[model samples]
Target: MSSAADSNSDGRRNRGMLKSYYTQGENSGDKQFDLDDSSFKPDQYLDFLLKKSSLNELMHQEEEIVQNIRSLDSEMQTLVYENYNKFITATETIRKMKSDFGQMEEEMKALSENMDNICDLSSSVSDTLQQKRSGIRKLAGVHTLLQKLQFLFELPARLKKCIEMEAYNQAVRYYTRARAVLNQYQHMPTFAGISQDCGSIIYELGNALKEKLRDSEASSKQLAEYVDLLLQLEEPADSLCDEYLISARSRVDEKVQELEDVLEDNSVDILEFVDIGCNGVLSNVSLLVVAYNDMFLNRAKANTELDSIALQKVSALVKEILHKFFELIQKRVQLEKQTGDNAILVRALDRFHRRLQAMNKLLPTAELATLATEIVYNAAKDRIDHYYQALTDHLGHCITDIRQALAAPKLISSNLDENSSTPLQNLVQTSVSSLVEQIKAVLANLQAFIATDITFAMKSTFRRPFCFDGVREGLVVRFLRRMLEYLNELCEKPSGPATLLLLLSKLATILEESTIGYLLVLVDEQFLIVQEGDVQFTNPQTLKDEAKAAAKKLLNNYVRLEGQTLSHMVRKSVETRDWLNTIEPRNVRAVMKRVVEDTSSIDSQVGQLYDDMEEQKKDRGSDSTKRSASGLMKSSKTWSFTPSTTAAVLDNSAFMTNISKLFSDKIDIFSEVDASRASIMTGIIKIVLKTLLECVRLRTFSKYGLQQVQVDTHYLQMYLWRFVQDENLVHRLLDEIVSSSLHRCIEPSLMENSVIELICERG
Candidate 1:
């Protein structure tokens, strides 16, 4: 309490001194300015000190602080001494552990050495026991050798007795065992005598087996036994069997020769020759399989059944024969390809497919049928592939001619003369004619192959899940698709004006339309039409339904493929920017006009077709009586009007329905020409508009030139309006063309000069 009172008194004195300094005017408005003032004296301010009582109080406070520091220093020394003792104790424990580990390691090393010594001692004892066991085994081997010798000595007598009794199985059993032993011991001096006797017995057994196998009069079972015995006797009868099978190939060769002669002699029908050749192959393969079994039954493993073996061998042999036959066919096809007689090759392929059907029926098992069918299918595919390549090659040659003609510059006349024989015109005509013939031939061949060969022959023979007739169809369809690609490439080039493009597009249009029609005809001819009162199709089975479905699928594919190709060709031609390639306006106009006229004519053919059909309907009405009489005369009295025989006569209604369906099926493709024409006209208009815009911006045309262009532009707008009926677009184009032309004629210079002349005249 006394210290508190003294501290309060000192604080009051310090406050008193601060109040005096402030009163000297550091913060006051009025201030004393006496030189004698302590606040104003600098030395007096530096001498700031506490009162004497305050100094005495501070010394007392310093003594207390010194005592507290001495107390903390003592506490720190105690903590340091305690922690140092703990650290020293931990160090001693670690040192002791290290010494103990060293001793343990030395004891472990001695224990390992002792174990090694014990293992060596036990191994020595084991070696001694092993020697004794080997001695016992050697004694046993000696006894086995004696027994083998005894068996070898008695084998010859036993074999002879078995052969005498015709116990071939027992003989085989004895011979197998004895031969195993003799071959095992032949290199040993102990069995030299037995080896010689065994060899002689083997020779005799082989001779007997050979004599038995050579007897062709033996039954199949008997021959099988002899073959087994010969295999046991180790003779070269395997080679003999192969030779026997090979001998049957001579018949194959003879048939092949006859077929070749038929191919050379057009007098012989190819279909008949194919039938004979295919039947010959089947018979030859069958006979060869039988002979192979008879000669090499033992070639099969011990557990394999004879029937299974026969099937396997027959399959393999059939594959071989088919391979060789297909090879010959391929060579002939190659020759036909070279001679440009693809028609004959196509017919041959068709006949071959028919023959393949016959052969498939002749096969005994599904597995064999599958193999044979696939083999022949692949062969046909290869041939068809080659045919497509030939078509492509021929087309390539024609395209070259077209390109050559295009390289030459010949103006097309405004008035098309039928007798004009310009080099380019003649060249295009010849090339197009040649290509048209080739395309027609290819289409016919493909149609023939698909309709007669695959649909009727192959598909009928092999059911679904095993048949690959679709592959053949796909081959031809895909080839047609590929040909369109080539045509598109040829037509897409910017080598000429729309004239060449127009011509090629027309050719493509012809091909597409004709192909569709041909396919429709094939479908109508090959598949059963849903005629009136057709009970067979009322509840169609899997086969009939599948056939119809396949036909529909083919038609769908044809439509899609043709539609895509036609649209692509038109678009590509329209986008071609080589408009300036032909500078003659008359020539350009003539080509464009021809294109427009061609499209109009093609569009008009639908009406013409309908008219023709109407005329036919009229003709048929007039001849209805005669047709009915002919039908009655042809109808069999015993034949009921079943689904197949019903509707022998086609009415105008049915014909019209078919024509409508045909049109509907191809509507997408048929509409492309009009669509393409509009697109091309728009493109041409855009090019003209672009040129007119450039002229207006550059201000390079005179009044007369602008007027002439305006007249021409008006004529063009009128012409294009016939194709495209977008009145707004036409108005916009006209506005821009006329406005820009006028702008170019009324230049800034002219405006300035006119204003100056008016101003000067007014002054």
Candidate 2:
């Protein structure tokens, strides 16, 4: 009900405002009435109008509203009539255009059918014409291709005719052209038949040329033709030509065989027979090279521009000759292995070496020259080896005799028995001097063969059984080393026999080298010793005893090695056979002095250790005391306290273990000695006694400590007895042992001091 009333009120307010707008009279304030509060109260508005105006105002406003309504309704009707006429005219025009479009489409449909009929006729006629034109063009292309490739079609037949006519040059031309075509079209099946035919022809050509090369009685011109044909073939022909030359080398075998027969008869001179055999082989090889070169002079000149294939071919032939030559010599030389007959055989070998050296100069190729060099070297080396073998055999029993003499001190005399005609004396002075001259001659020839540089020359050649690996020194150097090694063993055995020493000195004089001196240096360098840092020992007394004994034996061996052996060798020098002329004994004494100095160094080290332990003990102080009573004792003393005080072992100082280590380390220092001779042994004993005394003064010890020292002294004494067993030496050593043990560790009474003094003076 309120909504209906409000609608009626809005309608009344709108109508009144409309009536005021149309009837615009008098009050201009009524034109701007407030409509913001649109909640219209019609009765209130009517009352406001009634209070402001009369009924004439109301009638006049209603008549103006009717006039404005009539004017708006007429204008709206005119606008609708105009738009409706335009709509009728447009509809009529559209209907007329639709009829014309339908007629045009009907005419287009008929025209399209007519054109379709024309197109069908044109398509049929064009297909026939295009087929004819394609056929004509294909025929033309076939005719043109055949004309362009007419040479390819005739190439196989032309090649066959040329080969049949023995026109090899013409055939090669056709084959070369055919190969070019095949290379261009090889992937296509059309060329396969002709390519196979070409391959067959080439194979036939090669076989024919090989047959010509195989002909034994062929002249140089005939051989040259085959060589030229093979070169024209220009596939890798080195191996093929190598085989042909090897066949040519068969002639040398016949010559060598004849020489072998002559060599076997023994009536023929061996050197003359070898010369005949080698010259025949060299002449045949030279002829073979000349024949090969004459046959292909032009081709050879051309190929020489790249590599000397001709030289390679001829060098291969030369190698074949050398092969046969070595085989013959090696067989004959192998049959005669008697050292007594080595000189004649070696002389024959030297002749062969000379002939090979001449041949080496004649050869043009480096390969051939290298081959000749190898042949010469082998010959020279065989001679040298044979000569040395004879020398070694001659000296064998002498070496054994000398070794037996060296085994005992008085078995062999150091001076020559001038009145004696023993085999050893004869072998050393006579046989040995002659052998040294022979060896020198052989080595000189060898040095010449290798051109004074064996390593560089022989490195690119061959190595024989006696060759030293990585040796820069020549064959003589190695041979000298080997010979000296064998002789040094013979002569240096326990003051080597004087004759052997004399032979060594003679060899050194002959070679103008310090032969024995260098051998001594090699011995010294090879002197295997326990590196001082590597000599280890344990705390166990037995193990330390074993270590000390082994070390003593090694030191004695070193002493004997340097003193008796090396000193005797140097003393045997012609200028130094006696004390007045010799410094060897003095050198030995100097070595002994150096050994004493080394022991003195050990004494100083123990003294330093003594002071260090004193310092460490002071630092170990009351803390060490609270832990164990053994802390107050020296390291060597605590071990004597037994298993009952094992906990105190750790608290004991490490001084004694360090001393044991020092003892082991000091033992190695004597390994510098090669031998302990009579004088060397006495010097060593004095050093050991002084060292023991130093140990005594350096530390305060319990009974066990003194016992350890005594045991060590006894072990050293026992080792020394093996080299020196003098009773006075043993007695004096034992006296020091007892006095040091008693006066130093056991009891130091005033009365015993005199006894100690007497023992010390006796020592």
Which digits, one per residue and each the tens of the lDDT, describe model 2 over residues 401-454? 545643553323223222433333333345445545554454443333333233
Writing each residue's lDDT as its tens digit, candidate 1 over 331-354 gives 554444344343454465555655
TM-score of each: 0.39, 0.34
Best by TM-score: 1
Alpha carbon lDDT at 252, candidate 1: 59
Candidate 2, residue 270: Cα displacement in angstroms equals 3.9
Give each prediction's root-mean-square deviation over alpha carbons: 33.6, 29.9
lDDT of 2: 0.48
